[model samples]
Target: MRLQQVLSLVRKAADDYEMIQDNDKIAVGISGGKDSLTLLHALNGLRRFYPKHFELHAVTVDLGFENLNLEEIKALCESLDVEYSVIHTDIAKIVFEERKESNPCSLCAKMRKGALNDAIKQAGYNKVAYAHHKDDVVETMLLSLIFEGRLHTFNPVTHLDRTGLTVIRPLIYMNEADVIGFVNKHQIPVVKSPCPMDGHTKREYIKNLLKQLNYENPGVKERMFTAIQNGNMKGWPVL
Candidate 1:
């Protein structure tokens, strides 16, 4: 996907959810992965022509992994003229070495988000942007259904009253395949995930399951996204 195409989808999600307000400061959570980097590019492009005047900042919570290099990410942010910040923490140690949780994704995510949220709040940003896309939405819904016995996924716009920060998903309308296409086409610097359990998780299982289901029954993913849009879920944009 081209930058224009990416911006179109991002603009639609932003407008539909009223995500960007004039003079609002929004931070994009950069995980150094393709999805977040795509989001950074989309939002940066959107800022050029978006009628609503908002600021974009790129933030990453460094999990204190030795092999995690962020120099390229910093250069990318510089090229895009977006301010970037990295919150250093020993989350990897706490979750893996110290706590030794069997299911470390949950605790690691909690710590990562906590660090990200604190940085956003301290920076005085009102909203933060996440990179959860269409595939993630479907996978999360399936995970909820299969495990928690509920048809639930994240909202495009979420208000974290506790933190006084609203979270927005500008890339919610984007597909993961398109994200890959865009990244590959533009040669975006995507840092490989340094986590030991990058693809070995329940979400990965559901992702494969959903892929198989879509293969057996074509367009199932799109239908699932449509259902989510019309499910009357709180914080979801009313279609």
Candidate 2:
């Protein structure tokens, strides 16, 4: 996917969900992965012409891993002229060294989010942009149903009354394949995840399951996404 394609999808989702407001200072959560990097790039470009005139700040929570280098990401943010902030935390040591829990993804994710969100709030950003895509939405719903016994998924836009920080997922209409293509074609700088439990999680299981389901029944992913959009779920945009 090219810049034009990425912006097209992002703009559509933003418009559909009423995500960006005029003069909105949105923080982009950069995990240094393809998805988040793609979101940062898309939104950076979107601000150039989008009527809302939002500003972006890139934030990455440094998990205190040995080999997690964020210099390239910092340079990329500079190139985009987006203000960047890195919150240093001992999450890696806390999770793997101190706790050493067998199931650490949940705790690790929560800790990371807490650090990220706090830093975002400190930076005075009223909104945050996550990089969740179409596949993530469908897989999350599947995971909720199969594990938590609930049919649920994230919304394109969400408001946290407590923190006064609204969340927006502008890449909601994009597929992971398109993200990979965009990364490869544009040579986007992607930092590899240093977490030990990177690919061995319940969400990974759901993701693989969705792949098989798509293989057996072509277009199943689209169908599942449409179902979520039409499920009348609170926070979801009307179909």
Candidate 3:
């Protein structure tokens, strides 16, 4: 997708959800992936014309993996003139070496989020922007139903009372395909995930299932997304 299209969706989400306040400092959680990098660019461009002026801060929580380089991400941030911070952690060693749990995604996510939020809190950022797109929202709801016997997904705006940071997904209206197109069109450098369990998680399984279902029965995914929006799930805005 072009930058204009990306910005249009972003602006809609921010406006509808009241995500950006004047003088707000938002830390974009950069995972060195396409989704996060795309979010980084979209928010960076918003600084130019967004009515409610806000500053952008970019951060990556390094998992202490071997040969994990972030110089490209740093360069991209520099090109966009966004402030970047890299918080180095020993999560890799702890998860794979020490704990060695069969299901590492859950633990890894908790650890990563903890680290990311710590950085955001320390920097006095009141909000953090995640790159969860429409596909992720659907996939998560499916995961919740199939595993936990529940119908649920994250919302566009979530406030963490304890951390004093509100979570916002400005790309909530964006599809995963749009994100892939944006990254390819912009030549965004995405760092390959070096985790040993990259594609061996329940999420990966659900993602593949969604892709197959979409291929066989067109509009199934969209229908599911619509259901979630109207399902009256906690955290969703009244539609």
Candidate 4:
């Protein structure tokens, strides 16, 4: 059932945004997390039955995270017979040293994203796929609205034409619960980050705060996801 849900979302995203090509090379961004692992697994499964031919490669960035098991992620990819690559960067050091005035998460994310793009480009892949799901999009929407004074969510599809690359989110239709369930059922090896401030971040706050609202209004996240899909968001600024 988990595989089915994941495949459905991937196919839907591909069809909805024309993300896949006849002979495309896709580099999947993996962070040793549930979402990224599940995405890699699902995409590999989809490749068997997809009408057009496409290659799947897994890319991970080592952000100088403590206790990071680069070998474990490489082993998982090898078990699936997918090519894997890791880029090492001391992002934690940079974040700690340079980011004193602004929020670290935003800057760290920018650097990580840039690293992913560099890996994708260096690997000769034309497109990069991330593991952002429905709940992530909804959370980002609320975070932007409440804090950034805007109504915005990550797009299901994005084209970086200048870089001659495209970014796609295949799990945009699946929720966090589904991903967690899938990961637990499979007992996939997940490498945990050793950030002492993991749960104290603003994103975590919003997640918990939203959970309270969701308790009072069931499917609040689902409703927000629907609004993003059905709303006339074409004219709105897209990131």
On a 0 to 1 TM-score scale, where does candidate 3 land against the true structure?
0.98
Candidate 2 displacement at residue 46 in angstroms: 0.3
Model 1 lDDT per residue over 63-89, tens place: 999999999999999999999999999
Worst window of 10 by summed lDDT in candidate 4 = 230-239
Error of 4 at 21 (Å): 1.4
lDDT to native, each model = 0.95, 0.93, 0.93, 0.84
| Highest lDDT model number | 1
TM-score of each: 0.99, 0.98, 0.98, 0.93
Candidate 1 ranges beyond 4 A from true positions: none
| Clashes (N, CA, C under 3 Å) per candidate | 0, 0, 0, 0
Model 1 backbone overlap count: 0
Name the better of 1 and 4 by TM-score.
1
- What is the per-residue lDDT of model 2 for residues 1-239, given as tens digits with 9 covering 90 to 100? 88999999999999988999999999999999999999999999999999988889999989999999999999999999999998999999998999998998888889998888888888789999999999999999999999999989988998888788999999999999999999999998899999888999999999999999999999999999988888798788565
Could you list the CA RMSD of all candidates, in the order they appear?
0.7, 0.8, 0.9, 2.4
